[model samples]
Target: MAHLPQVLVFGPPTIFTQFEPQYSHKYHFLNAWASSLPLDQFLHTHNYEPSSIQAILCAGGGTPVTVHVLSVLSSVKLIVTTSAGLDHIDLLECRRRGIQVAGAGSLFSEEVAEMAVGLLIDAMRKISAADRYVRQRVHSGPWDFPLGSKLGGKRVGIVGLGSIGFEVAKRLEAFGCSIFYNSRKEKPFISYPFYSSVVELAANSNALVICCALTEQTRHIINKEVLLALGKEGVMVNIGRGALVDEKELVRCLIEGEIGGAGLDVFENEPHVPEELFGLDNVVLSPHAAALLKSLPLICVTLWQGI
Candidate 1:
């Protein structure tokens, strides 16, 4: 009998349902936590024959599973992923194993950028607080929520002007906001003012939007210093990795009014937000669902074909 090429997938089943819907039956899926996975036990229990597995796919964030599975599947030919961040993938290991890795480039960039804009606007306008007030039947009198700043006249700073950050700048440009960016290398194509450092960006702009990729160099890049630079009048928005921001410092800054407000889609410890931020009216929180949109399925299909 001819051997069927075996593919192993480690991620949400929904990605497979979206990417290879018709060919789903051809692959074997071992759904495991993106960050935490017991590789030895999982392999022993499932009888995972590494030699038989031809390809592996990691759809979620981080490099843990990619490292674990690639260490075992030395002969696997391909490592396909839907996520753009490869910090979770061990490229060195893949190179050593002769495994080719592919990913979606800017497919989800616009989607994530749009969410970042939404979070910024929501935070500035206190949309969540207004919604809560309405929900709690506090509408007996005239609504007195203070008017928010308009994006058109404000100085907007974007950290790490990569794919998503560039898209965010383009979108914010339509609102007439003056855009400033901070990246290691200045983008040749963009004409916007560039800051050499994150603190410089924070110091100049009224609102700071973080859309950088998370890496060893960028982990917890936004700390108390950056927050203090933002000052009490500035608003902060993070659509990037939670690890990029210091959560404890953020709570301290917010509580002490060091910064005006914040909108966060991703937290340092996800699904479990800091209890201190719960009662604060200036904060708008999301459950790391910024990248998840209705168009994600179509985007996944497009990325698969490109790979």
Candidate 2:
């Protein structure tokens, strides 16, 4: 009988372990966390048979795929991640080492885009707020509820024109939104007005849907200046990673009415949202559960094949 190819796994079991029952018969997964031997010791034992360790599987942003980790497993040529964002992986090191990487790609884009749009509308329309108002039994005299801004004719700016961002643009266009985008560079095929600077994008937009990847260059991309550009009437929806926006600055802006409103699905710190946002009605919050794809398990089934 032939032995299955070896794969080194590192992440919380909830993520990496889900694939175990499906792929156990097909491959050998060496879970780093389950090993009594330290990860360094485990890799050292494979020095002579480095090629046996051909793949490393990591949870999208849960585990850090540092250069050191890659270097230790010298012969690993492929990395399969369960998430769309690669911010957690050291791409520079992967490039230098000539290792290939693949992510969930377009499979996760539609769902995330849906969440982004939902948040955008909720921020603009105050759906969550209205729901809370009803639940809290605030039905009195005049039923004084502020009117939600209409979706039609709103100028929207998408920070990244990637798969998820493109999907968002398509959906919003159906609702009569004018789509503009700012990306690393202009994609000529796209007809939407392109801005080189996010600040400029915000200045012209009524709402900004943040779908950009989180990187060193993009960290705090939506800073105080950008928020100021977005102005007091502008709404912001962040379905992307938390660090893409300055959370502290966002909270302050929402508190001081510097910006109109915000819808946040991801946060700088997971499961720990700012208590200040809790009391604000203008801000809509989602528990980062928006993109937990229903098809995720199927991805694990075909993961090895995709690589």
Candidate 3:
């Protein structure tokens, strides 16, 4: 019997969970969650030789492949993350170690873009609040309809003009939205009005859609100043990582009505949303599932190529 290649799966991601049965026969999987030992100890026990492990399959919400993890897995030649954002993994360390790293790339771009637009529409129109109002029957009168802002003719600012951001812009264009954008550097040949500063973008636009990556520089990028610039009538939508916005400041802004409302899919902490946001009728919240779909064929293709 030929020895099957061993693959260490961290978080096992959703795709792995769905396809494990079919892929199990082709690969020997080392599931970190199933073990009681620390990762280092688990690897030491399972891997008799350092060169035995060659690749690691990491996912969002999984253990980050930090420097310490890289140090222990010296023989690992490749690291594949199930997420498009690489903030969770240490890219600098991987580069220094000469380890090849692969990501999901643009697999979720369209889905996430759709989700961002959906969130924006929901926030502007108070869709979720209306649903709740109908279900609870707590309204005083039949005419107590939840009024919302119009998406058409609204000036929308996009924080990042990457694949996901571009798709968002395209969709918003169909709704007759005036698009403005801010990126690390201005993209060439793109016709959208560019704002070098995020605060300026917020001040000028009726709404801001956050689609930038989370990094040391970008962490809390949408701080009090940016939110304040958005003004009282401004709406905000975030499909990017949670840390990109200052959660505490955002909560305060929402409660005090500094900003109109927000549509949030991610939070500073996973599965632990701020308690105060639960009651706000202006706020629409979703678990970090913007790109969630019934099937994930693109991720499977990326994994196959990476491995």
TM-score of each: 0.88, 0.83, 0.91
Candidate 3 lDDT over 1-307, as tens digits, reads 1387777778535567776677778777778756768787887887545467788887765577899888877788888777788887889998888988888788889989999999999999999998888888865776586679999999999999999999999999999999999999999999999999999999999999999998898999999999999989999999888899999999999999999999998888865899999999888998878766776745565566657
> How accurate locally is residue 18 in candidate 2, as Cα lDDT from 0 to 100?
63
Measured with C-alpha atoms, the lDDT of residue 235 in candidate 1 is 94
- Residue 157 displacement (Å), model 1: 0.7
Ranking by TM-score: 3, 1, 2
The per-model lDDT (C-alpha) reads 0.79, 0.84, 0.86
Q: Candidate 3: where are CA atoms >4 Å away?
A: 33-38, 41-51, 138-143
For every model shown, the clashing-pair count is 2, 0, 0
lDDT of 2: 0.84
The lowest-lDDT stretch of 10 consecutive residues in candidate 1 is 28-37
Question: Top model by TM-score, which number?
Answer: 3
Question: Alpha-carbon error at 144 in model 3, in Å?
Answer: 1.7
Q: Model 1, range 188-304, lDDT digits (tens) per residue?
A: 878999898888889899999998888889998898999999989899999888889999999999999999999998788655699999999889998776777767777666655
